[model samples]
Target: MDKISRLRGFRDIWKDELEKLRKIEEVARKYLNLLGFDELKVPILEKTELFVRSIGETTDIVQKEMFTFHDPSGDSVTLRPEATAGVVRAYIEASLFATQRITKLFTIGSMFRHERPQKGRFREFNQIDVEVFGSKGPLIDAELLWLISLILDELKVKNFEIEVNTVGCWECRKKFKEVFLSYIEKKLDHLCEDCKTRARRNPLRIFDCKKDECLFLTKDSPLLFENLCEECKIHFNKFLNYLIKFEVKVKHNERLVRGLDYYTKTVFEVKSSALGAQNAFIAGGRYDGLVKEMGGPDVPGIGFAIGLERLSLIVNTGNPKENLTVFIAFVDDKAREHLFRLVKQFVKSNIRVFYDPDSKSLKSQMRYAHALNADYAIIVGEEEIKNNIVSLRNMKTGEQKSYPNDLEYLIKDISYTK
Candidate 1:
């Protein structure tokens, strides 16, 4: 018989890789808590309409990537490809807006998308998502960038760049779309099939294309920033100024329209050169109309999601070290009985211990301890039992000592030595 293997585009996380992921999550939680953001956990499965409505019907995630299907009840459901939609649904269903003037939330979990998996891209991926609702000011936008920078800095991620852009509001986009459409129409023949479809359905998305031909043709296209309305221009300028005031350095990219349809006015991405073509480890923008679109009251939102897989590729978590490791070695049946008691005591005291439950010989047990890189070995036998003392050997120094059999004394001595 053949053994079953993990599905493609998925991976088993363990050992050092898992440790690094945990460290990154820990740092994210620490900063989010300090910034007064509460954690919110949402289900991975959501109604298919939730995404089709929020992420946009013409977006790639809805058209091609979503893992959507009908369940036993015959209602369309999907494994969430992103989090904002689900978060918004929760906010409305829970009537959170009725009580709080402003709400800030952060969530850490897995998202599913059926796209071609690459170095940092996966069908099943993890993200640290943060969202702020109610305020439409540029201050929160700048502050979110600062928070992202703080997290990356704490994780020792170096040489990353923050890129910013403004897609403007719907009214500004309405005017820009006309001019953008004309420019794209002239070069539609030279663009890829996907870009051509985008040109017809959502011309702004052409700027998100990665093909050299599409990029070359759109490089000279009209700039959305230059065409921004008076209101959008003022908001964008304030956003840039706020970033400067916060001492958060950012590069303005006129063509940096993110792939999401809900984005309006401000958009940003954190890029790392080390990650190559898929360099963006963090990306998000304001979705001022999404709340109302999701059947909630008119509210504004700004948020970002950090791809842990891409982040882990660049972050150095260093060697994971155990605080202390102990091994219990016993010689005879009586000594084995004592080992069991000592093991329980050590565990209760929050110590890591290793022992053979099958009553292996003292030599065999000590060898196992050495293999496990134990810090110390506690040897017990009839002699020590009669003497009412236990033998403690420093595995590193090859030195030995005897302490009273009392669990308190042994625990204290081990801790003090450590």
Candidate 2:
């Protein structure tokens, strides 16, 4: 018989890695709550059309990366490759904007994309999605950027930099795309196959290509920032001023156009040099037209998502604390049964314990406890069952004591030890 294996690019987080994920989640949760953001859990599968309409048909996600399939009922459905589109759909379906002029929301979940898996990029990955709806103020962009910096600083993720730029609104983008098209047309035969297709479809996507030939040809390409319309220029300028006021260290990269089509005004990415090949750990920008474009109320929104897999890969603090883990050993059927019954109480009370229910020998159980590096161990035997007490041992100090087999009493003892 052959064993089954997990699909390529999927992930199974365990032990210390899972601890890091939970820690990062709590860190984001704390700051988001302080900033007054509400939590949301949207479905993983949505209508395929939703992403295509929002993420742009020309983008790689919709074109070659989405895990799309027809549903049982024949409706085209897709596992979400990105979350903003689904979030906006929910925002519209719930009419959240109508009830409150300004709505803030944050979500943490897995996003599926069928791209070739890299170091921290997987087919199914988790993200911390943060978005604010219903205000066009530049400070909102600054605030989102500040939130990114705060989380990274708290995580002690070093050597990360924030790169920002503006691609202007559609009107200004149209003017600049023409200038880029003319420059690339002269060297069209020399460009990569992908960039040639990009030239015919969406010329601006040329800046997003990483092929060596494309990168060299576009090195002297026209910059969109220099050609932005007055309104977009002023909006971007105000966004820059607000970042300064917030004391954020940002580098202006004129070529930093994000992959999504809905972005306008200000766009940014929080990059870490420590992450090779895939450098960005967090990125997003202002999308003033997405809500309206997706058939929702006309409102402005800005948000960013942190790739937890990528962030956890680079952050230094990922070890799990063993002091919270307790081990329970038994030497008889009666004691084993009692321990099993007490297991429910420990679970309900948020205690983590390692237990062997087969009444293994004390020496063998103690060796297993040592392997787990448990902080405390409780020996259960006929004597313990007869007395209705527990023989608790502090694994670190080799101290043993007898205590009433009461959950509250054990909790009190544990708390005191802590």
Candidate 3:
């Protein structure tokens, strides 16, 4: 049989990378809790309709990137392209919106999308999604954006810009779409193939197109801000005022039409040149109509999702911790039994031990101890077992001590956190 290999776009995360992921998640959890947000977990696989309805059917995530297949029961299920839709599904089905005016919740897990994998993007990726439900005021939007800024600052990611835009409400968006479409119709041939297709379905997506030609053509197109309805204008201005008061540095970008169709009013993305021309560390906006669109109450929500893999790529933490309490070294098979008992005793007393039964020679075992950075190496031979004592060698200074069954106390004495 031929040896199997991983698919082209997928890459495995090794032990070190996994450790970094854990650290990032830990910090994110702490920050989310500090904001009074509770943790929530949703499944990876969900019914295809959830994404089709939440993320627009015309969007690339639904039209191309989703991993969808029929289940054994003949129901179509998709590996979730994003977690926001499913999180909303749970909120509706469980009636979470009925009671709480501001339910701050968050989730950290992997999201799947089928795209040409590149730096910071993958077939399998992880994100930290946070949503503040039932908050219609612009305060919630500013609060969420400011919180995201704090997280990036804490991570030491210095090179980033917050691009902000307002898509206006339903009434204003209707008129903007009319003028916007006609403005770009003359330059249809100049657009990339994908942008040309999206022009008919979603003209706003054309601005987000990465093609240099399309970018140049739409560089001076009509902005949504010019046609904001009375209510939307007030909301956008209020949100801006709050951001200023909160001291959040931001840039006014009229072209930021978030990929999701559900977003209305405010939309934004945190861009970084460090990740390349298409870099965005976090992206989110106000989805004022999504809750109701998903069969829930007429509640509005705003939130953001941070790219964990992208954040981990730039985090330069010094090497992962190196500390072990007991390193057991045995001379022969006869000493194995005694070594096993000592190992069990150490573990029972909540002491960390590192040992390999195959390692026998004192020199080889000492090398292993140094590699593991063990504080003390426990040497056991047939003679030591007969005397009910074990030789403990200090790996740091080459000092030796004999312990008569007080392994737990000795380990605690040396392994104090400085």
Candidate 4:
């Protein structure tokens, strides 16, 4: 029979790659906790209508990317393509707004989509999603960008830029859409099929199209920044000033209307030059009306999502070396049981211990220890077992010490040395 294989666009992450992802999560959690954002874990599956209403029916996520199906009960459900919709649903259903005046939440999990896989993009991916509700000010917006900057800097990601723009609220988009639709209508014949469809439904999404023809045609088209209403213009400018206060350098991109339809007032993306065309490792913006639209109170919100796969590609996770590793080497079969008991003690004391279960020769066991890059080697023999003592050798320095066969003393000595 042929060997079973993982599905395309799905991968098994382990060793160094898994370590890098873990490091990213660690850094994200540290800062998120410091910022007072509580962690929330939402389900991987949600009602199909949750996304259609929040992400918008015209968006690609709703129209094409979602992994949706009718469950056994015959109700349509979807594996979340992104996290914000589910988070919002939880916020409303749980009535999180009744207590806290402002709520900050973060989640880390897998999301599924059906799009064609490419570099830094996948069908099943992981994201570190952050969201803030009940605050409509630009201060939170700038602070979120600052938080993102801190995470990238700590990860040692180099030459990444923060691109910012305003897609404007629904009222502001009304006027801009008229001018945008006119320009798109004339060039619909030359645009990609996707952009052509986007023009009739969500015209602003035309700017997000990656096709050369669409990009070239929309390059000189009307910009939403120019058409921003007085209120949106003021809000955007204040957001820029707040970003400056946070010392976050930002590039104003007039053409950046992120792939989501819920974004309004402020939109931004963190892109790395190292990742080529698919450079954005982080993307988000304000969705001030999403709460009200989802049948909740009129709460304002903003947040961002970090693509762990894309981020792992660019982050430098330094060395994968973990805690001290000790190898148990025994020369006699009788000593094996004693060493096995000692090994259990070391593990209980929170030490990383390794032992050969097959009673291999001492030389073979030593070689295995060296191969594992263990920090210390504990040698046991019938004589040492009789004496109630063991020989501990520093794998690095080759210095040996005799310690009484006491778990406490052994653990203390190892802890003190390393």
301: Cα error in model 1, Å? 1.0
lDDT of each: 0.91, 0.87, 0.85, 0.90
Rate residue 106 of model 4 by lDDT.
95
lDDT of 3 by residue, 329-377 (tens): 8877788877667888778766788887685677888888888888888
- Model 1 TM-score on a 0 to 1 scale: 0.96
- Note each model's CA RMSD in angstroms: 1.6, 2.9, 2.1, 2.2
Collision count for each candidate, in order: 0, 0, 0, 0
Best by lDDT: 1
Clashes of 3: 0
Candidate 1 regions exceeding 4 Å error are: none
Worst 10 residues of 2 by lDDT: 316-325
Return whichever of 2 and 3 wins on lDDT. 2
Q: Which pairs of residues collide in model 2?
A: none
In model 1, which range of ten residues has the least summed lDDT?
409-418
Reference-based lDDT, residue 86, model 3: 87
**Candidate 1: C-alpha lDDT:** 0.91
**Can you give the lDDT of residue 401 in candidate 3?**
80
Instruction: List the candidates' TM-scores in order.
Output: 0.96, 0.90, 0.93, 0.92
Across 1-418, the per-residue lDDT of candidate 4 in tens digits comes to 9999988888889888999999999999999999999999999999999999999887778999999999999999999999999999999999999999999999999999998889988899999999999998888999999999888889888888999999998898988999889877878899988877778887887888878998899888889888989988999999999999999999998888877778889999999889977899899999998999999999999989999999999988788757889999999887887865888888888899998878788999999999988999999998788888999999999999889988578779889866
